[model samples]
Target: MKRRFNSIAPSTLGLALAAALPCLASSTAANAAPAAQNETSAPPADSRRYSARGRGDRRDKWIHRWAPVRNMWEFGIYGGVWFPSKHLELFGPTMSGSGSGNQRLNTVAPDVGLRAAYFPLRFLGVEIEGGVMPTQTRSSDVSATAWALRAHVIGQLGLWSVTPFILAGTGLVGMQSASPPRGIGNDQDVAIHFGAGVKVFINRWVMLRLDVRDVVSNRAGVGEGLTSSPEILLGLSFTLRPKKKKARPRDDDRDGDRIVDKDDFCIDVYGPPPRGCPQVCIDDNDGDGLDNTEDTCIDDPETRNGFEDGDGCPDEVPPELSEIAGIMEGIQFDTDKDNIKSTSKPNIDNAAAVMKKYPSIRVRVVGHTDSQGAYKHNIDLSQRRAASVKRAMVEQGVEDSRIETAGVGPDQPIDTNETADGRAKNRRIEFQILEGAASKTVKKRGKKPPKDELPVEPTPEPKPDPTPEPAADAAKPVDPVAP
Candidate 1:
């Protein structure tokens, strides 16, 4: 059995190595040559600067550092076969029959024992064990079973994944015999043991292990001899909790962008230059004049007058105005017509309500006609139609000044006019606000005549008198007369 086991061990090791080679090769390829070359070539400038700032290995210098794992505790169970090397003796006079020339010698016996160990330190431990095993003897043909308890101090070396350990201890052993049948007896004894083992961490919580130990013990009685035993075991271990890492502190200068709160200068509104503010921080994110930090509607540029504090974005965009051309219901229009059919009234009414709500908002009303008619006539007709819509809005209480009317004669169209639907869409009206009206109020003051209409230019205002000249002129006159 031993020869077979020894022969199989090499095969198993070979298989394991074979299985690991690809991963090992990949890791070596990833980290070996290129990394070494990079390190040699770059010679990190920062590392040199840091070393100059300190003496010796700055890598080990005491800087604020984080440890991912520190203090932890583990628990586990172990099971193994025990073998005893010590000899046990039967304590009786030599077996003899008087004058019969028959004599017998006392016997020496050996037994096997089982054990358990607990490790308080990862590398060292103490073990307590108890077991009973049958013993064999030479001489009187006496047979017995020995029961023993021992305590051992243990030490381990090598990688945590595969550690080897040595142990030593002393304990009391009790024995009972048959065939001269001596009853139970006790003796103080010492034991020495050594073992090698491996541990596999299944996870943070558990580990599995296998180990073997050889034990030796001594005893004295009618006869003395040496005993040797070996044990094999499998075990499982557990940890109470894993260690937690400390967080690293950040180094920041002028951290005013809300990135590092402690180092921030402008905690509320990020400023530019020395404050580390964003480039666009001052411009309204919503284009609403209110900076992004304060604007609730950062995406829209319109303002809400009632709130007065929000960025100019309206609390809500009017649903009617949100559409592409502010037309809903798929309403189609005839060329150059201001007269909306009954079907289109609902969409128009919705837009009208928005205009009424935002009374200060001014809209440009543009009319377009298809290319079927003469361009000039189409332009005239479209202009008339746009004026008609303006009149309608004015009648509907929308301020005339708030609506600018214009006509585009077949210039802008949604699609090719070769198609009927495209031509119909081409003949349409659209509303857009004058660019700056949202920021500045729109007032409908009467139109003043053009500068050309009111005389080519106003008579230049009379130049102001350059100076009070009388005193100078009188002095000059007197001087001239004297000359």
Candidate 2:
């Protein structure tokens, strides 16, 4: 059968090219724009130049900026028109009863393709590309699909964010069709391809690519020549970057210990020479004078109240003693006399109640005098006052032996003696534990008595006991005398 073919269809080719024009134009315009427009708003100073002040070259500036693209793998998909040669050979019948003659494959075929490339260096790479074009023979109603695959070596140059490249490679081309023309069923050929493309990098990972390639293949059957097919393609590509290898540190000292991390036992801790680690020497964690090794209560410092100073524990005192001290705060005496005020009888009774509450702890009635009087007279008066307090406690059901008396006579002032408040504090009575289950002391400081109250006559002073008085008070601060 003789066959005829009109010119190739323009609609398919025009529509595909139209779709790609806007993108191509925009990319080209962007790439062609002046370098200044694409530069950073404030351009980085050229490192090669010295300052106007004639200092030194600014070589280290912008050293930390990251590269947009380097060695990477690219994969892309493209679609465009494949324009085949009009003289493309197809072995088939050209006329009625003819066994072999010239016939043509379809001129215009819509082509789709996939491309993968790897760039080991900045300017060189290798790519493997595969494409499919669906068309038909010009003389018959038979449909056919043509496939071409090629591997190419690419050379490229990076200009700003765009890369323009050229490639050349060779691979296989094949055709599959139903009831193909005579002498031509399924045919395969060795094809050579040369192409040039440009990649517009949108970001570090995504890019737009436009390529045009001339695919040359040997004519099948009786023809001894080759035909060329041109492909115009536009595609989107994604680049994958290889993970960076970490370099070993030459010498690293994180803790500023003067020791390199490799040989240092504790790289993070600043310490001494040998191990480069800290040695915790906690001789006294509680700051109680005694070493932690000998301290029974390492967390709590010792009271050191002259009770049991050897044992490193805070001496536990009865709360009743504090209550008795509070009650004695109301224990006012007649001015400069051992006589107890009659109005202070209630406070004396309350103090006796606290002493009776915990009868196990022994009590001492120690007296203090202000610096107003002669030292010897103050001592004599304070001693008589302490005796009176003891007598009162004894009358309130406290055992006479549990209460002892002493007079410090302004020697140990808890506050400043220069002030009136300090003198009032000095002239106070204290309750100390002479022999008790818990070795602790309590002091009850009295405010000045009201002059309107009557004074009880002083009783005879008790005989001095041979027992020694405590050297000092406990670790706690003395309570101020209440008004």
Candidate 3:
């Protein structure tokens, strides 16, 4: 009988192997085709294949929904220790000397198995396993082997490098005794198992797997009851399917601009800049009629009030300031002294009045002296003269804070100092309008302008014509005479 059983087992094993081999080959080919298809660049025809089905196709939607781990396979072999329950019943008759109730399976045995799993979705998989355990009846000392074939539904949570899973399954468990003094040579029972395990991925294709499970079975015939066998297994698993490659996107420029559409600010309009648009299409941030690239002051609009209009800066010269400059003359000072002459009072008063009319205007009073004196002394005299003019303006209702004073000796002379008339012209007062306009020096004209050029104002009463005679020391004083 043992010989017959051995022969039948080999035949059954051969048949199972033959059936499984073809399936394995077919599955491998099918899985490889997708990988090969993904390996090369997809042709234009192939790219349109999915588009023909429309974007909302259910099959395509379902496949892409679980992109992470879908269509993956894992195959592994494991070895572990199986602890049989004390309630495991024996099939053979017990010896006359031994109590029948005392018969049980061995305490522990080595168990090994092969498992194959398929992941249809990211979080779920189905696995099939087959295992064998060598054991013996403890009381009887009869050698036996146990076999388990299981099918499990696995639920797993996949993280970066680790996956933890729980599984439950039902299958057939068979036990074969070696030369047992029993009625039946073998026993079979239906078994159910549940377990939890973790897989630690060592890399893209290899992983370490561990499991702990409790398998429960119901024995048949007399002395029958439920038996529990617990197992702990550790092994390695390898991915059976190659990863599919992702398609590369095409770089296109819809507007014929050099910039790709993905980076183009204006995808529909063609022109300069990475914006893919015309200069006119861009905003004038300063409202200065110039785009940001052309405007030096992007935030400040060009005044466009005639002066330096093309510079895209604010430089509007107030007309009132120009008028004030025209009248700022004849503010003469005593030779080498900072005292303003009484004769120049009208001009100073006129300037003060104009400044008062335009309260927003500020001016810088600059003094000049002929180069007839020591350079240092001339500079000092010029500064004092400028201050004197500022003081007079302040006394006449103009805010002292609105006026600034500066002195430049004969270095900036507008006329030669060789003659008295030229010297007189050089030692004159000038005004520079400092606010809301470009700075410009205003000198008194040697001759009076036409009535049309003179700004309308309260005319001063005419005075008797009188010119002071030169001081006796002024004819021949220092080698470089002071003006």
Q: Specify the poorest-scoring 10-residue window by lDDT in model 1.
A: 61-70
> What tens digits encode model 3's per-residue C-alpha lDDT throughout 215-256?
998753467578778999998888754433422222244455
Q: Per-residue lDDT for 180 in model 2?
A: 30
- TM-score to true structure, per model: 0.33, 0.39, 0.39
Cα lDDT computed for each candidate against the true fold:
0.51, 0.66, 0.68
Alpha carbon deviation, residue 123, candidate 2 (Å): 1.9
Residue-level lDDT of model 2, residues 133-216, one tens digit each, is 888777764677888888999888854456788989999887776543442456677888898988777655678989898989
Better model by TM-score: candidate 1 vs candidate 3: 3
Q: Which runs in model 3 stand beyond 4 Å of their true positions?
A: 1-68, 95-102, 182-184, 219-225, 250-483
As for model 2, its CA RMSD to the true structure in angstroms is: 42.2
Indicate the residue-level lDDT of 442 in model 3. 23
> What overall lDDT, based on C-alpha atoms, would model 2 receive against the true structure?
0.66
Please give, for residues 170-207, the per-residue lDDT of candidate 1 as tens digits. 66555555433232233345555556666565544556
How high a TM-score does candidate 3 get? Answer: 0.39
Off by over 4 Å in 1: 1-74, 89-154, 157-182, 221-227, 239-241, 246-483
Better of 1 and 2 by lDDT: 2
